[model samples]
Target: MRIGELARRCNVSTRALRYYEEQQLLTPGRHPNGYRDYPESAVETVRRIRTLLDAGFNADTIRIVLPCLNGDDVDMCPQVAAAIRDTLHGIDEQLRDLETKRGRITALLAGRQL
Candidate 1:
């Protein structure tokens, strides 16, 4: 299928698909007319990319983790495990900061001055 069809099927914009290509997250073949030709599996790949992005993973992290998500034996790589662990740690720190902000807001709403 072409890029438009893939975008329609994936419910994402063509710009997003192009961005994915630029990020090296998606690889579509090129037609003689200079159009992108995507395989059927591109739909599922896009879905997965959306899911990861929704979960706060950046394109680079997603690139690193895609092979693992695709059921490869990446667990054997200690560096991959470390990178994932670091990402999780960062997420936990962000959650803690958000919780602190929420508590301050709650206190302010409760007639307490910050």
Candidate 2:
């Protein structure tokens, strides 16, 4: 398959595929005429890449974690574990702040003295 075909199969744009290659996320072989020649597996690879990106993983984290992904076993990579822990910690802090704001709003709605 070529870049366009790979993009279509993966539901991504050709530009995105090129960007993935530039990020060293996917590596397609060059054709004799200098066009890209993507293996059939490129479709799945692109999907995995997009999934990681959607999960708040950056390119560097994805590069470190993708190779360790197998059958949903991402924790096998220590980097993946660390990244997930950090993301979770950030979420926890955000939740605490939001809860504090909610309490303030509730108190104001009840006409409570602050």
Please tell me which predicted candidate would have the highest TM-score against the true structure.
1
The segments of candidate 2 whose C-alpha lies over 4 angstroms from its true place after superposition are 90-114
Listed per candidate, the RMSD to the true structure in angstroms reads 2.0, 3.1
RMSD of 2: 3.1
lDDT (tens digit, per residue) of candidate 2 on 15-102: 9999999999999999889999999888778889999899777787778878887756665666678876776787789899999999
Model 1 ranges off by over 4 Å:
71-76
Candidate 1, 65-92: lDDT as tens digits: 7667753334437766776787889899
Worst 10-residue lDDT window, candidate 2: 71-80
lDDT of 1 at 34: 93
Please give the lDDT score at residue 89 for candidate 1: 90
